[model samples]
Target chain A: MSELTVELAGVRFGYGAAPILDGVDLTLGAGEFSVLAGANGSGKSTLLKLLVGLLRPNAGTVRVLGGSPTDPDIRRHVGYAPQGLRMATSLPVSVTEVVAAGLAPSKGMLRRLDRKDWTRVTEAIEAVGLGDLSAECLFELSGGQQQRAILARALVGHPRLLLLDEPTTGIDQRLRPALVRELRHRADDGATVIAVSHDPDEFHEVCERILVLVDGRLQRITHEEFHHQFHEHGAPG
Target chain B: MSRLFIDFAIQAYLAGAAVGIAAPLIGCFLVQRRLSLIGDATGHLAFAGVAIGVAVGVAPIWGALLTALVGAVALEWLRAKGRLAGDVSLALIFYLGLALGLVVLSAHGGLTASSTGVLFGSIFTITWLDVWTIALLCALVVGAVALFYKELVAVALDEETARASGLPVDSLNVLLVVLTALLVAAGMRVVGLLLVAALLVIPVAAGARLAHSFRSAMLWAIAAGLTSTLAGLVVALLQGTIAPGGTIVLAAATVFAVAAVVGRRAARRHPRSSAA
Candidate 1:
């Protein structure tokens, strides 16, 4: 029973010949909440993906939940919400179905959702403020609303380890505090939450320390330092 | 309608009805995923497989299934590798499958009757066995679709998010392509290889236009597929010369055209929210 929820040492990764991440080392403990912020294409997304076991490092060890990331059990307990617009509006799925899919894999092959599953799905939808729109087609949603729906899907399973890349990109600033509180509650409920954001202030009260990426390297910085660099230096979007 | 009616017409009608429900049931997901061309690609490969099966004295449907599976895997692989876009893979597969089928057909002149059946299906030619084949396959296709319904929709919505959530994106994608292959191979007997994709796509597109939810979209698609088949079969029987394949595809297209108009009118009546 390792205390760390995520561990990566001497991690190296590249898409083709160009190195996207190299010589990186990181560790996160159980129930820890942390924020990773960096400029665009600064490997913030990559780190979140690694934690969720979505990508494998080329040259180093990546352990999630104290075991191989490729393990099915490890994958089942982890939830990930990727960055960017990941919806195909052409799909006819409703908000409920989209979030219900978070439970599909765990239900295993050839099984449909039961009463308990739907209950959880409803609760998750409500948490993201899309309870009224759960029956509406996802394509009918605004971008910010859609992003929150994705967040709800990620949190539906109450995963032991959760990773969100740029969770606030399309979200409204007014909704920021409630979203932070929601994530904080999940962390308080004994889950490790690692979020990637450009604005650390959104997560200042939730995270212990801010992790910054510079030239594919990881650096630990204080919240004050993060805000200063973020606002004054105008860290590239 | 009196003289055009044949003794074996019931089998053809039954087979068509089965495919009408099954093809569009799968097609709804395909159209949503924008992989509507997969049916055409698989149909072509199934043709090559059928030709080889005819030459070897085996069930042509089995041959078609094997070839379609291989082609589906190839399409999935090529699409995943980033070497080619999905439609590009579809085009490449259909061309190769047709080329392979032609070569095999040219080598066996005695197999003309069988090949003709696959290319331009005859409702009068359908036997009770053919109906059974269509029924069993249709049941399997529909069953698989229902069993993995959520997973399939999840992948179609967004592969990355689905994968991040621990759904087997690759496996589900493979299953979907193979199921598409199965539908096309089963449908080839009724709709013919050339028009199988049309049967898969048109009904689903029509359904998507009218539907407000996923379940409704699937139901509409199934209705469209069944209606097109029933209407097309009757028209073909009355016309006496036109194949059911052509008539069925045309009927589906007409349904789609009508749905397009209705959907547009409805959209105008209720404007979408200002967020695409």
Candidate 2:
């Protein structure tokens, strides 16, 4: 599609001899909010890593935003929040600093953040409801708060494509809706959002499509079918 | 018109001042990356370099710099390749340097008077030429850190995120180790090879205990470094018998002890600002 944000064609990948993803082909357009669901260790995170260029496929191509994901020019317009990723507590980096790091892709190296860039950092912090804790160390925050800060980092760039892995892992249930709504807003603003979640219902209101990984292949199913399959098979893998 | 000898202690102080400022500037990131021991490892490698230089009749500082640079680059390469665990590589480098230096020196002759100076540090033996050389290296280190502050912070904070964000993660990692090598070479004469890592790590610990952000931690670490170094040099000057290297490390340790206590109390008082 002319407005497609992601395209994967015959992609195959694995850690060693065993394969995780085999002959996978998919496409998603701009402004689409999608959920990737599978059992634990079913290659959902690996697939997201491929989209972000953190991991390369063993075969085939993964194109994001009209170019190879590994290209710096292309990556500048992509944002990713890895699963359960946390900075070392020994480091004294603050919330604002971590969120500001999100701008590095856009700014490149050797260029300092201007006043406007910092203001955007602050705006991202406030948007994630961490306005009061902007100056606090990231490790000092609760797990949920840290996840929110990470979300803010992913959101700060206003990227054309956003990939989040277990974005709601530590987020409070009461706050999950707000988090999903934020992702919804970003997708509505034309950013392609693909999130890996064990429970896709958490994103039921915002997600337009659900993709399940089973036998190293992607299967697209409707919400009703997904619910039936979930109850029938215990969980999709 | 010139005296037969100038105050070498004064020369040592001048050079120490540069080290005090630069070592901790590099230390902030090293400590953040949990590679504090890299300083110690590089220092030992520099010692081996210095020994080889002495054997070949080159300036020991240059030898130390060359060897340390090569060693830093090698360690980074190994770690980046993921063939060796980071700590294992560091340990191998550390012991290899120490043994290589000792064997080389023993083969030439037992530890000479100069070798002892390189080990324990001899402030009264510093030449004015050394002052200028150390100052130049420290300036270069400081300038590089300032220029790459944002990229360095992003990489040190979380490397995966930084790489995903399009930063040259591998290049930045190499830059950090190169800076560490340069610092070890610069400070070896003042802090001695055995204790140089103290300068790279202790002040950072003290600063991290009291500062809230990476920027402030660096400022505080630099402040602590200067205080320990200048004060230790003064104490050595007054005492006349103490080694400046040992005194400087002690001063830094004292600062860390006090900061730990004060930081604990402050954390109790303002639970949210403990990171500061």
Candidate 3:
């Protein structure tokens, strides 16, 4: 296994004239629980996209598992859950189908699924405590349940790195802790996890290190330092 | 009741109903995903194909099918590039196809009688061959959709999640675009290019107003499609001079209007109910 699961060496990205990430450097080693903290338009989401191979860096290099970010083989080792879940609300798909999509990168374009694929899918549903709801329509589930379903999808592929963009934003506050715990559990299992969030306090205990983005620039800090900064800034009473 | 008139009406109804049933089964997903314009665009592309086939002495159906497939690929490529929105791309492709079709018709020497037949579908002129073709195409479309239902649903709902889960989101999206093209080519003969989009969209829109679950929406859309096709055929036969395409679109629009009104009334009566 590579020492560094993901390495972004001085990456620069932008849309049109506005720069979203300006000469940002990042690295996630094997089995690290890293949190990306930033306000809106701070380029946190764009950085996640760079990690997952969805977007290429305008300058510098983005390497995932020692391969180009866009490589399907490299992507297979990365599990990504995007922010919004409203993209496919009208389709009548079950939870199982959604989770099973995680296996797609490994399955190739035209290959048929065998028994092993089914086992992975079943295990993924079970991991998220959604075994009972596997057959249920996704739209019928609560916001938290939907978030779990998305998590199951990211986990099913057993990727080396997990890239989640605001996985708990819409989830209830009660569920947020449990969700972070689940993510930490995955990291403990030797998977490099990088989660993007604005809620630094909620993730302080689980995230070993925090990377802050302010106006598209990057700053690395320890959890204690992040907490100290937050307290100094007057966190909510 | 005249026996000859009744027989003609029945045959026309069967032909129209076959395409109608297939269109909405495909349309429900398209409309839900905001890809409704793709259906309309492909239908017009098929029209241009038919015109080209007539001018070049090839089979019109085959020509229409090839052209629709090409248009589907073109649409997918444009979407992948992220240069334009799906609706904008669809509108551009559809108009380009129409312009090409007009050029082909003029090069072939103005408006011929065959051109008129293609524009305003001659339901009364439908042969047994046409019926068989529609049946086969419908069966194929239904079978393909059923076999890939799981993947299709996942892709249509949330493509990003689907891709993460390892579903071939791009391939599935391409398959859907190609399938829409195939359906349009098969249906162009029954409902002309100008009105083919109505067959695909109206029933789904109407059914969407009344359906609770995804399955129920598709079932209702299929039923609405069949009903409108049958009713339109009846009206077309009764009037004897009206185009079948116009009659069918009008009939579908009427069903959609009724469903919309009924849905709105039901929602007012029971605020918690899930209609529309």
Clash pairs, candidate 2, are: A214-A237, B210-B276, B211-B276, B212-B276
Residue B210 lDDT (model 2): 92
Per-model TM values vs. the true structure = 0.94, 0.95, 0.82
1 against 2, candidate with superior lDDT: 2
Superposing all C-alpha atoms, what RMSD in Å does each candidate have to the true structure?
Answer: 2.3, 2.9, 4.4
Q: List the residue pairs that clash in candidate 3.
A: A88-B157, A101-B165, A101-B166, A102-B165, A102-B166, A103-B165, A104-B166
Candidates 1 and 3, the one with greater lDDT? 1
lDDT of 3 at B254: 96
In model 1, the clashing pairs are: none
Give the per-residue lDDT of model 2 (tens digit) for B1-276: 122124776687688889999999999998888888878888999989988987888888899899989988887887789865757767887889989998888787746787987876766677888889899999999999989988898888888988887888999999999999999888878888888889999999999999788888889899999999988887777777778899999999998899889889998898883221
Model 2 complex DockQ against the native: 0.53
lDDT of 1 by residue, A26-45 (tens): 88887888888878888888
lDDT of 2: 0.87
lDDT of 3 at B108: 77
